[model samples]
Target: MQREGSPWRGLGVVTQKELSDHLSSARMLVIQLLVVVTGVVIVLVSLQQIRDITAEDPFLLLRVFTRSGEQLSFVFVMTLLVPLLAIGLGFDLVNSEHNQRTLSRILSQPIYRDALLFGKFLAGLATIAISLTAMWMVVIGLALSALGVPPNGEELARAALMLVVTIAYAGVWLALAMLFSVLFRSPATAALCALGLWLFVSILWPLLSGHLVNVLFPPSATTADALLNSLSMHQAFRRLSPGALFAEIVTVLLDPAMRSTQQSQLAAMGLALVEPGSIPGAPLPLLESVLIIWPQMVGLIGGSIVLFVIGYVVFQRQEVRA
Candidate 1:
């Protein structure tokens, strides 16, 4: 029998309830605190290093995020921490409902399974957006107060785009965690699988992609064609990892001088041979930077949607018995 009424009838109600629960949860609070504290310390450290050259740099505000002191840059730190936050929020999203025996009860009401799943995802994404926005604001306020320099319109626009990209990056991991949550009944199993995948993709994948490329396409003795092919293949493999995509997007968005996302040995050689008239460090227009990262943005958002759809299919098929 066809279901009656709209599938999204109670989406707002479910989203509101889930958002409330997430906001009040101690797990979320602790995660947010950890991200905030780490970001602030890194920003402060980087600010000290950037202070001396404030006059020389036109985009000092952007530098606050991309510049690192002795540790990681704020942008890199976010790349690492945002996934953890996303996983923490979603690793138990569906399993916890099953464990508490609330899945059937919740669905037995006027709510459809569609509303419930979508609402949970929207709530988690919103929570991440809120946290990242607050972090960005804090960083901006600190830059303004410490450096007494205001950002130009273009700098603000670029930072805003970066914020949007970061949230999309978080969504990819959140959806993956939720997919695992739907697959496994045990929350522990779901969380472990999610974290393990994250570790492999974020840390191990980049290291292995080059080796895998070399194996797949051994360099030829006489020509650079095979070497170029290997380098291209390596980048393609790296882009499969969301972390690599996020890092590339952030690098270009934060620094307008960045011309391309190509980081291979061949790309470095190509850059060295650029014409003498080429301006290497000239800032790119905001639209040009967006064009550079448009594919990466699509990849992150597309990955999230694909993962969420898989989880939705699995959730719809599974029986929710009380």
Candidate 2:
């Protein structure tokens, strides 16, 4: 009874169904409205700041936009927003189906379990992309109107890269949410667990790292400089968190110039330059900064993919009752 055509036929059909369902959902409308409103607020604030600065300068708008962009990039917003949105969207993905007694009927169709999961994941990702894209457009338009010129080619390229990084960052949370949805019988439990994980990674983990380092090496005058010269517990803790990784990546991409600042500090610290002249005065290249962040991006994205795959496998094998 199996069709002899493409092996992905079932997957395609499920994806279509998922997309259709998402498009018709009221949730999408509400999310879009919120994103638009937030974007407008950011632009208005930036414009007001520009007005408060030296008004006669032609480059005033550019300076203001650059400063604003540095402060409110896509990555920064995604770091804060992705977990909440992903958890809300996915915390009940499976549990609700079972609660409504629809899981049995869905499984009775020709679609494979893998297809169902894949479809749902793609649909959620699509929703995130749409919301982010709309926000980015609004920001860009506001920048253009306020600045009186379009963004340069390099700036545009960076903005596009920022968007991609944001989506990938959101993927990590979405996968985690899906995993919890499959693992927990109650949607509320899944959402709470997701929030707990977010708090641990974003806030508690860094605080614990700082406390542990202080305890391990109580600061002496000499040891103070040495401890400061050593790895930054803050940076190390940040590297441990996906949100921090996302922020660093966005910063590096948007302002490639900051690479020099990072390199200078690293050189000064790596060489134990307590006197500040132990290392040469050469600045770091933009390429080097990009190279440093590339591994971090790979790690975060890979971790997200691995988690998603694990969740998918677990969900596929799960026994659902009507």
Candidate 3:
């Protein structure tokens, strides 16, 4: 039988309900508090270091986000924390309804499953976006108060792009958590699976990429070009993980003078120093930096969409009888 009306007939209603629940939930409160507290400490530490070393730097505000304190920069800290926040919010999204025996009843209403699933995902993403935006503003405010200098137009633009990229990174994990929730009936199992996958991608993948690259591209002693080829392949495997993609995108966006990705920046700069007429440490135009990391940005967004589609299909096929 053909269904009537739009698949998104009650999308707005479902979104509003879910968003309200997410924003008001105790779980959200804890996650936001943890992120905000850690972020503030890291930024403040970075501010002190920036003041002492780079007081005359033009991009002082950006350093507050990229500079490291106790070996942890705000950007790196977000890369680690964002995934956990996403997973916490999404790990039980669908399974909790099933465990409560409410899934069937919710479907019994006029709303289509499409709207229900999409709405929940959107609600989760919006919550993360709001939290990140507020934290970003707070960090900027603190930096301005300490450094006594406001960010220029380009610095603001770069920071905004970083925020967008971080949200996209969160979406990737949120979709993964929701996918596991749809696959498993128990919420604990869903959360465990989502976290296990995160550990593998964020921690283990980088460790193994070099080994895998060597196995695929083995060392070639005869040709000088062999090393470059191997390094490129290694970077390729590392970029498969969403964490690496996020790091690469922010590396260039936060540091205008950085003309190379993390993997190649040091080597590229060394070469520039020796080569006559080459300008080392010169900041690239904002547009040029965007162009360099554009592929990584696309990869992060694409990964989220792929994960969401997989979950959508699984949810659609499963039977939810009362």
Candidate 4:
């Protein structure tokens, strides 16, 4: 007979121990320092351009998170660097235990593999959470203190949403790193694989997306067919890369005047929508903003869960010693 609480037994202990190790580790410190440094640089470098542009802005505080007109934005920095941090934390998560001759020993205890995997993943996520939270505070604090403008209620709510979106995005990378850690026995192999995925997705995927889109939607089609094909290709291509999905979400959240799509709505309202891009207008309500990017948020969160589940299944089926 199975014990009633045995499945979840020691879950908390394992999570706490792993989380503590991550928090106190030198690696975490270095990653966090990198985040802090990058955040400060973006804020300082873009501060002037953002100031010049948003001089009359009501939501200037939120601009810190989104403004990258003259330089890379804060969120952009995260998109580039956070994945590396995640990979660093997770590339060795499972394989290191095996290398240390501890996996079999740990499983020989009462703890379920379920608990062990969940605990370790949670710990890595917690470390990422800590890093993100600190960076959020530092970036906003510097912006507010420098600009001398406190965040309005709407700004606060939107910033919170942005943070949630960011965490989900980071989780996808963390899960991928863990998946690699599980699939590859060598820690270096896992790290290199994860890093390779990051580079290809972040750097090469978009270029390929463009070429593929052009090849699939040639100029010979009718105008209406071309437009439809273009729109469909754009959406499909955007969904292919988590980077594009995240960028779109952040753009809508941070820049209130930014009205990228919704041409029909503008046309219905008898507004002259700009041809190049939607003209700047009053910022959308928080509810409206979230509704606009809800699909992207779901894609990011869903992708993370799917990756995590794959890792979980692989971990469960593997020979305990491996």
RMSD of each: 2.1, 4.9, 2.1, 3.9
Assess every candidate by TM-score.
0.94, 0.80, 0.94, 0.90
Measured on C-alpha atoms, candidate 2 has an lDDT of: 0.71
Instruction: Write the candidate numbers in order of decreasing lDDT.
Output: 1, 3, 4, 2
lDDT of 4 by residue, 200-260 (tens): 9888987788778778776466565565557567567856888878877887788765555
Tell me the tens digit of each residue's lDDT in model 1 across 1-322: 8878999989999999999999999987897788678767867887878976656788988988877664677666877798899999999999999999988888889878999999999999999999989888878887788888889998999999999999999999999999999999999999999999999998898899878877877766645665556666887999999998998899889898877776435456663324377686788898998898899899999999999999999999999983
* Model 2 lDDT per residue over 228-299, tens place: 544455466557788878877776665545443244345665642333653443323435656768877897
**Model with the higher TM-score, candidate 1 or 4:** 1
Model 4 clash pairs are none
Q: Output the better candidate (1/4) by lDDT.
A: 1
Q: What count of clashes does model 4 give?
A: 0
| Worst window of 10 by summed lDDT in candidate 3 | 266-275
In model 4, the worst 10-residue window by lDDT is 260-269
The lDDT, on a scale of 0 to 1, for candidate 1 is 0.87
* lDDT, candidate 3, 1-322, per-residue tens: 9988999988999889999999999987897798679768877788778867857888888888877675786766887899999999999999988989999999999988999999999999999999888888778887788788978999999999999999999999999999999999999999999999899998899999989988877877645356556666878899988999999999889888766674344365343323256577878889999998999999999999999999999999989973
Question: Model 2: residues >4 Å from true position, as ranges?
Answer: 1-7, 50-66, 69-76, 216-229, 260-289
Cα lDDT, model 2, residue 104:
84
Can you list the residue pairs that collide in candidate 1? none
